[model samples]
Target chain A: MKLATIRHGATTTAAVAVNGGYLPLPARNLSELLGTPEWKHLVRVATSSHSSPDVIPRTEATLLNPVPAPAKVICCGLNYADHILEMGRDLPEYPTLFAKFADTLTDPDAEITSEHSQSLDWEAELAVIVGTTLRDADEAEAAAAIAGYTVANDVSMRDWQSRTLQWFQGKAFDATTPLGPVMVTPDELDPEAGVQVICTLNGEEVQRGNTMTLVFSCARLLSYISTFTTLRPGDVVLTGTPGGVGMGMVPQRFLRDGDLLRTEIPGIGTLTNTVRIRTRATIQSV
Target chain B: MKLATIRHGATTTAAVAVNGGYLPLPARNLSELLGTPEWKHLVRVATSSHSSPDVIPRTEATLLNPVPAPAKVICCGLNYADHILEMGRDLPEYPTLFAKFADTLTDPDAEITSEHSQSLDWEAELAVIVGTTLRDADEAEAAAAIAGYTVANDVSMRDWQSRTLQWFQGKAFDATTPLGPVMVTPDELDPEAGVQVICTLNGEEVQRGNTMTLVFSCARLLSYISTFTTLRPGDVVLTGTPGGVGMGMVPQRFLRDGDLLRTEIPGIGTLTNTVRIRTRATIQSV
Candidate 1:
């Protein structure tokens, strides 16, 4: 089942993507939909009923990130062994975790602005969306709590990220990170079995890896994360990206003003974002 | 003017602390109050008229963290030179910033439970609350955006914190960090000039420093943070702590099951939380 959030003028609402069209759901957004206890049953009923009331063609409706304002956005760092070796670093024993606020999220097709940084890089990743609230969860509990999976590009600013020991400031630029086209249910998409995740620069393939290559599995990461903080229904865990970031390139290539970044996972979908460098006037005015 | 949030049964609401009493505001919480355009003026109107039809005395009203659910809780790491030196690190060129989710926050007088950690540590910090939204803001703009100042203890689980290179996991435990008794407006509290910040364990003065020693001032940090993400009302920045945490002490002291942790700033009120180690059942049950 594919669930998405589609924008309608001033408001965004959760909708079921069906046969190249969106059947608008009563819920405001995927975050709100997941918070409800009987979301699965509710979505099933909405999916089966013919009276969608307002079905928008997929191409016309603006698709946003499945979970626009998640309660928590926990990102994993150094989870890919290939990426680690490429960067000339040893594989870490534990998953290096970090945080990104909700404001950092942008639409799937939104323009990525290079305002504070010109050295923008792209990292293709598989994202896990939580369905149920879990705390101190075991492996089975973590597995049971899985709602679905999506695609994301952990767009990073190399300069600001390396300005200090922490990677948050650089990685957390507002509306810089592109997420989603839709979320595919876990029954339909199992990243553990090795799904191809790819990134392209202007239709040229740059990054390629299998989700099975992750150092930590989704269940293990979620269980570990739940040890400290409660994983809410709409919380998202971005499994770290594989190799082929701009930083690891031969000449350290970066995204130019008009560069297009396309992030894709076969079972999920694609996110195409155009990089736009903001001028001095536009920088301070935002 | 002082404002607070007080718990009534399971729900909490915004309040004004006046004349040693709490006047329940119409808004849901301090976050909601600050989100309004003219909160200061509205609060003033609520304060002077004496029509606090639902007033609760400060003693009887159970105060929660003033900002119960901020959109973002950005914690600055190693801001003070003394603490940075004590921790065997050089002064950083940029402020070390990390994040804590809203779940990590606990009430000022709530029991500070040591769930998975016996090596609980304390970091006394002055907190800045944002009142308006701003992006790429100047120092003057940053100064104007500050709504107030408060007290917080960045309680840390050292064992988990040092598990990886990043400190997020160890720092963000459910309801671990203590914040707020009340929020003092910036007109009353200026952390730049040097305000006394202290942390005591069972009445033993362990950590002591002044805000004057902070490498990054409030305005500077706000300005720096604005470069990437917009600072919205109800967002909080927990300025990094000063020296003398349990992690920095000789012989390495830690929190016991029944230790009293008190965090205080001169202008802002005190936060006294009793440390209680979570039982085996309580650990997995939450």
Candidate 2:
């Protein structure tokens, strides 16, 4: 089943996309819905009622992040062997983990702006969204913890990232992570299977990779990160992107104003964003 | 007035600390209270009703982070002149900003642990908690955005921090930031005035500094960070720590098992933590 959050009127409402439309769930957000045991019941009901007329039209609403304002968002670095090789860096002995605060999250179609440095880059990744809170989780437990999957564009500022040893400084600028059109639950798709993840600039494909190239599997990465910190319900794990980052290209390809970035993954749906460069006066005034 | 979050039964409740006791507020957490326009009214009521017998006593409660899962927790690097001098680095041309996920936050008396690295360190900093949602705020507006001040110990793992260019890997381990015994409102204390901030190891004073030595004042730091991201209600800014971090000492001092860290500021209350090192098997199994 595909789940999502949509802006109804004054506030956001939990939803489940069905047949070409969205059905509002009887919950506040994705976190609350997952916390209740009703998800399993809902899944059972959904299968049998697949042909029911309870579906709401999707054109009447605005989409939000599937799990807006999660407790944690863990991101991996250099997890793709081909990407690692392209950067002239050795394969990491252990998964390199980092974090993105909830505030950095935005809807897939949201606009991103960065004036501090104009060297913005795009990375298309398959994001795993956790369904249950799991700490010290084993592989099997990690698998059970996963609720669904989504697409994310890990937008970064190259200059700010290289300025310090920590990528977080450059990685966590406000509205940097564009997540979700909808969350595709594990029952609907096998997360371990490779999917064609692609990043397109305007109308042309610039990045093409598959989850099959990831050095660490979803379960292993989740378990590894849980050892360092707790993973709460609604938290997301962005498995690292494959080779075609704007920074790795010849002469470099940084994001500029009016550039549209569309990232898609099979079964997970598409994430679209537009780039807007901050003006000098706006930068200084801020 | 000072604010805090006390876990009562299953839910967390907001409270205002006064005299020798705490007065329970009608809000769930600091963020909720700040989001309401009645916050100033609530403060007035809390202050006037301090001596009223109707004020209930908080019983058997566990204190949570004063901010209670903020929108973001922005941290600065090398914002103190003395700290920059000690680290053999020049003063930053701009405030170096980084972030800590909400999961890294622990209560005042929580335990800090490390699994990947053994060389852990402690940094006592004056944390500014935003009272109002702010974007593109000027210095004056930034000062107005501040809700209160608290004591935070920004724990670090030296091995991960120094081994790479990005300090985030080491700076953001689980339970790395212990924030608050209570938040002292701006009306209660002047952050610019010299307020003795101290950190004691076991029972001996190992670090002593003053907010007066901060290279960028709270207003400037807040204003500078706003340029990068929107500062929302309950968002916290960890102004840089002064010199005397364990890493800056002769031969260097690092945290080990059974070590106790007690950090305090003049107006704000104290925070105590115990450090524990995780075993290899324990680390892997998690």
Candidate 3:
């Protein structure tokens, strides 16, 4: 099953993707919907009968970030072996972690703009959402708490990122990370078996890797994180991106004023966002 | 004026510290109070007429962490000039920043326990609270937006921190960081002129530094951060600690079970937290 937070006219709602439309759920967004303990049962009941009047046409709805108000949005760095090797680092015994607030997330098709950074880069990743609370969980228990998977582009500002030892300042620019076209349930998609995580820049393929090559799988990462912090329902954990980032190129590459960035996963859908780099002059005028 | 979230029996309320008691505000906590646009006006009106029946005696109230639900909890690393020099690094041109979640916070007098780490350490510092929304703000604007100042101990797990380049995981253990006894408004306690940030272990003093020596002032840090992220009312920013953390000691010290850790800022108040380290055996038994 595919789930989404969609905007229609003046309001947004948690909806289930139907044949050619969306069936509205009870809550305003997926974040609120997941907060309820019986969300799965509610989703089951809502989808049981999607009457003609209850379903909104797909063309009339605009998909938003599925879980926008997560208490935590954690990201793993150097999880992909190929990416680690490219950066000349040894495989890590523990995952390198960082954080971003809910404000950092943007709609699937929104424009990602930044004026403070000149080195804009891209990291296409598969994000996992938590279905249940987890603390000090083992790998098996972590797997059982899986809610679903979505697509995200970890858009970064390299200039600000390189200014300090921590990557948070650069990665946390408001509305930089584009998330969700739809969340695919774990029962339908298995990242462990394999799934291609792909990224394209202005129609040119830049990154392509399989989840099978991840140094830390989704469940393992969740278990490790829960050792110190609690993972509640609606929280997001982004699996690290694969190799072939622009930062690793011969001369390096950055997004221009109007570059189109697309991130996609086979089971999940694609996020189409246009990059808008505001120059200092443009900022001063505003 | 000193503001706090005081617990009376099972409920908590945002209150102002009056003569021998607290005058209750309209909101449940400081976080909620700060969210309203007319909070200052409300505080003014409430304090003007604090009848005996409306005031809760000081002895009857227990103080919890103020600003419990900040959307963002950003922290600075290596901000004090003396601390930076002690670590053999030059003053950074930009502040090194990281993040913590609301769950990382506990009451000022709460017990801080950890079962996953053995290298628990303490960092005493001043914490700044945002009073208004700020985006791309100048230093002057940022300064004017400060709601108040409080005390915090950035408790850390050195073992986990050293496992990766990022400091987030180590600093983000649930309920490890102790924040607040009370919030001292800008007019009352000024960090720029200098405020003594002191820390003691057991009964011996370990660290004492003045905020005047901060490499990045509170206003400067806020201004820099606002360039990339939007900081709203009730958000928190913890300035880095002074020179004498357990990790910076000659023999390298760590907290043990039943150790009393006290963090104090003269005009503000002190946080008395007992450190409880849970061994693997103790965890297994539970």
Candidate 4:
């Protein structure tokens, strides 16, 4: 089953994709639905009845991020061996974790402004959405905690990221994380198996790699992170991206205004965003 | 007037601190009360009714974090001139911004376990709680955005913090940010004026400094941070701590099992937490 968050009027509504259409769920947001077992059961029922005429057309509706306002947006660093080598870093002995706040989140179609940052770059990553509250879960338990998978563009500012010891300063600029067209449940694809993840700028492929390169699998990541903190129902874990980030390029290709960024994972969906520079007056106007 | 979140039964209630006690507010949490015109009115009423009989005894109930789940928890790095010198780094040209998820938050008397980390440390910081939604606000507008002030202990793990270029991993361990006892409204204290802030370990003074040591004032920090992203109601801006972090000590004093951490500020309240180490069985048990 594919789940999504769609904008209906001024508010966001939980939805499930079915036969080229979307069925609005009786919930407010993904986080609220995640807290109830009944919601998951209802999603299965809704997906089974997708062919019925009661389904709403997916078109003519605006799509929001699949996992909006997650309690925690956790990210991993150097999970891919090739990417580790590209940045001249050693293979990490343990999974490196970081976080992005809800304010930095943006929808797939949202604009990523390059304001105050001239070295914006893109990293294509596979994001796992948590279904249940998990803490100190073992391997099997961690595997069961995963709800679905989605695509994310870990847009970063290279200059800012390198300025300090903490990468969050550079990684959490406004509208930095472009996430989701839809969330594809594990039944749709093998959660452990590798899948193709790619990124393109202005219709030109800039980064291409496979999830098979991940040094730490999803289960290990979930388990490792839970050791330090409790994983909430609506938390998101972004498995590290494979090689081919803009920083890996010889000349270091940075995102510029009007650059179209397309990030995708095979079974999930595509997340496309355009870069724009925010001016001081324009920012003040918001 | 001061504000706090109280757990009454299964629900979290927002309360106004009155003389010698508190008065329950109409809101559920600080986040819900922010940005409401009625909140300002409530503040006025609460201030005038400080000595009223309706005020409830604070000892009769539990006090939770002032802002349990803020829209964003923005943190600054080495923003104090003394801290910069202690860390042996040059002064920063801009306000360094990073973030922590809402899940990392806990109340004033909450227990903070450093089981997963062997080098946990404590940082006493003055946090600015946002009252209004602010984006690219000028200095004046930034000052207007402040709703109140609170004391926070930004607990960290040095090893995890230095694991990557991003400090989020070490900064966001579960139950790390123990905030509040009360949030003193702007009318009660001048944020720009320096205030005494201190921290102690096991009843021994470890840090003592004034907000005057801050390289950037509260107004400048808020205005600068808003340039990178939108500051929403109930959002918190943690102005950086001073030079006496445990990691900066000559012999390096990391938190160990049974260590008691107490942090306090002048107008705001004090927070106390005890640390416990994580064991293998403990990880499996959870």
Tell me, by lDDT, which candidate is best.
3
Worst 10 residues of 2 chain A by lDDT: A277-286
Itemize residue pairs with steric clashes in candidate 2. Answer: A165-B165, A165-B166, A166-B165, A166-B166, A166-B167
Give the better candidate number (3 or 4) by DockQ.
Answer: 3
Backbone clashes in model 4, listed as residue pairs: A165-B165, A166-B165, A166-B166, A166-B167, A167-B165, A167-B166, B115-B278
Computed on C-alphas against the true complex, the DockQ of each candidate is 0.56, 0.41, 0.61, 0.45
- Writing each residue's lDDT as its tens digit, candidate 4 over B1-286 gives 7788887657677888766777877788887778575788876676676656766676776888878778688888888888888889999876666777677788899888766677788889999998887776888999988898999988988877776566777787777899998888888887567788899999999888799878788888888777767888898989988878989998988887888999999888799998887643332221
Candidate 1 per-residue C-alpha lDDT over A249-282 given as tens digits, one digit per residue, 9 for 90 to 100: 8999988888989999997899999999775434
> What C-alpha RMSD does candidate 2 show over the true interface residues after superposing them?
3.7
Cα displacement (angstroms), candidate 1, residue A162, comes to 1.2
TM-score of chain A of 3: 0.97
For candidate 4, write residues A1-286 as lDDT tens digits.
8888888667777888877677878787676778777778978777776555666677745777877768788899888898999989998877777777666788989999866777888999998988877887887898888888888988987876776666776777777899888888888866467688899889998777877778888878888788767887778999988888888889888787888999978778888899886544332211
In angstroms, give how far residue B33 of model 1 lies from its true place: 1.2
**On residues A1-286, what C-alpha lDDT tens digit does candidate 2 reach at each position?**
8888887768677778877787777677776777676675765566566664656578776888777767778788888888888888988766777778677788989998777768889989889988877877888899988888899999998876776555776777788889998888888877567778899999889888888778888888888777667787788899989889989999898998989999999787888899998755333422
TM-score of each: 0.95, 0.89, 0.98, 0.91
As for TM-score, the candidate ahead, 1 or 3, is: 3
True-vs-predicted CA distance for residue A90, candidate 4, Å? 1.2
Model 4 residue A95 lDDT score: 79
Question: For model 3, how does the per-residue alpha-carbon lDDT over B1-286 read when each residue is reduced to its tens digit?
Answer: 9999999988999999998899889999999999999999999999997788998999999999998999899999999998888777889988999999999999999999989788899999899999999999999999999999999999999988878899899999999999999999999998999999999999899999999999899999999899889999999999999999888888999899999999999999999999988775432210
Model 2, residue B128: C-alpha shift (Å)? 0.8
Candidate 1 lDDT, tens digit per residue, B231-255?
8999999999999999898989888
For the record, the alpha-carbon RMSD of candidate 4 to the native fold, in angstroms, is 3.3
Give iRMSD, candidate 4.
Answer: 4.9
The TM-score measured for candidate 1 stands at: 0.95
Superposing every Cα of model 1 onto the true structure, what RMSD results? 2.8
Count backbone overlaps in model 3: 0
* DockQ of candidate 4, scored on C-alphas against the true complex (2 decimals): 0.45
